[model samples]
Target: MKQGIHPDYHPVVFMDTTTGFKFLSGSTKSSQETVEWEDGNSYPLIRMEITSDSHPFYTGRQKFTQADGRVDRFNKKYGFTNKD
Candidate 1:
């Protein structure tokens, strides 16, 4: 461990711009923005374009590739029927 060589670790707020979700965590990153937390204290606010709250993978809203309808064309060409 070294002294005076590490970035300051402090509580920071990460805000999801799309979902308006806020998360509090410790970070060495700094921001010029600030926000009042629920604890009645202000913390550095970092605005993010994407987070778990709005991410497709995390929200289970992922958009699957259509494969250019190749599967359907193959099935039709082979006269194959899909079984439910």
Candidate 2:
């Protein structure tokens, strides 16, 4: 590994804005914000809009699309209707 060419990798705290969940992980990304973690040490804080904690898929809150309505619209456009 080259010494001066590589970016500094250090512990970073990722905070979910919605759920307020925080986790520490190593990253090359830098931040002007700092947060004191559970270990009583400060690390660079990164704010995220969505994380596994607040994501729809991970939280099992996924919304179902109305494909049936779309199919009806497509048929109507082509002058076709459902047989049954």
Candidate 3:
């Protein structure tokens, strides 16, 4: 609650690269990029690699680690005796 003690919470735009989706929001995070929003205003742009807009989990296409042939290879390399 002191002056100059808290970081600035200003307008920011998060851009999704994979989906090319952008939205206007506010945050304390800092960035050097500037972008003109759809409302005809400019704000600091924060480029994000992943978000709900283009995430595999939200899209229901998530991929998991392949455990079928990996277990045999791991056991052969490290001599794991436990099979169960």
lDDT of 3 by residue, 18-61 (tens): 78899888899978889999889989999988888878889886
Q: Write the per-residue lDDT of candidate 2 for residues 1-84, one digit (tens) a residue.
A: 667998888999999998899999999998999999999999999999999997888998853355577878899899996678
Task: List TM-scores for all candidates, in order.
Answer: 0.70, 0.68, 0.67
* Runs in model 2 lying further than 4 Å from the true structure: 63-84
Please, what is the whole-model Cα lDDT of each candidate in the order they appear?
Answer: 0.91, 0.90, 0.85
Candidates 2 and 3 compared by TM-score, better number: 2
Across residues 1-84, which tens digit of lDDT does each residue of candidate 1 receive? 989999889999999998899999999998999999999999999999899998888999854554547788889999998789
User: Candidate 3, which segments miss by more than 4 Å at Cα?
Assistant: 63-84
Q: Which candidate is the best by lDDT?
A: 1
Report the number of the highest-TM-score candidate: 1
Candidate order, TM-score descending: 1, 2, 3
Model 2 backbone overlap count: 0
Which pairs in model 1 have colliding backbones?
none
lDDT of 3: 0.85
